[model samples]
Target: MLIILTMVLFALALSTIVMFISSLLSKKTIIDREKSSPFECGFDPKGSARLPFSLRFFLIAIIFLIFDVEITLLLPLVVVTKLTFIKTWVITGTFFLLILLAGLYHEWNQGALDWSS
Candidate 1:
């Protein structure tokens, strides 16, 4: 226990020293304004650097990801069914599938599935 404590302390001290030295070395002596601006072939930029994002498309993507992961989880149940009794397997599968369906229904009811507003 003492040896482990000593090793951990040594590591902590070494990391702290390294971090301090790195911070001191990385300090910027001078800051330039033109260098930070977005460049456009030696000309001034016309528009903002950030682009507009579609929230509806993002919602659809998130829904697809959730359903995709849930479907993958269902794949393991195929092997589980072969190892378990018919009644238990049926009940377990039905419950899991129902959960997935219910989630889908909820999303649909909330109009999140609709692409056109």
Candidate 2:
């Protein structure tokens, strides 16, 4: 009981010291307008929210997110292969890849992927 109590006290003291040191170190000695201003989601927080946003840029962002999610979803298949049969793994992976490719092709055909108009 005494050893545990001593350990708990030591941990609390150590953490408090570390936190104090970090707080002291992280303080900004000099403040600037650009550094102080809040920036959010590729847009200036100080700018008018009603400003026109590009539809093409939004579409490209959506496409990037879709492909990023596809990569995350496909990565689990590598780990799952050891847990499942080879035939089942291959079929599922191939089907998923084909679906992703089809969506990409459709987007390309629709000119959503084109940079120059």
Candidate 3:
């Protein structure tokens, strides 16, 4: 129990010191106008909350989020491939890719991917 407590205290102190040093090194004293603004999506953070938003943008964001989540799921397959049978891994990876491709194709067909309109 004493050893465990000592190790925990050491870990806590080490983590706190590392965090403090990293924060000090990376601290941004000057805030730039572009940096302060919201990301590429043009809606101003301080603007009217009731302003109408583009549905096309919303759909694009949803699709991006769906694919982002799928990517996260797919990343684990690289690690799992070592533990699972080669045939099983291949089948799963192929099926997942096919589903992703089909969804992308459907969205493209629906004109959700078209920004020019």
lDDT on C-alpha atoms for all candidate structures: 0.86, 0.91, 0.89
Q: For residues 5-73, could you state the per-residue lDDT of candidate 2 as single tens digits?
A: 999999999999999999888856556666888877678887789988889998999999999999999
User: Cα miss at 21, model 1 (Å)?
Assistant: 50
- Candidate 1 lDDT for residue 58: 84
Could you give the candidate ranking by TM-score, starting with the highest?
2, 3, 1
Superposed model 1: Cα runs more than 4 Å off: 1-49
The lowest-lDDT stretch of 10 consecutive residues in candidate 1 is 27-36
Best by lDDT: 2
TM-score of each: 0.54, 0.67, 0.58
Worst 10 residues of 2 by lDDT: 27-36
lDDT winner between candidates 2 and 3? 2
| Pick by TM-score: 1 or 2, better one | 2
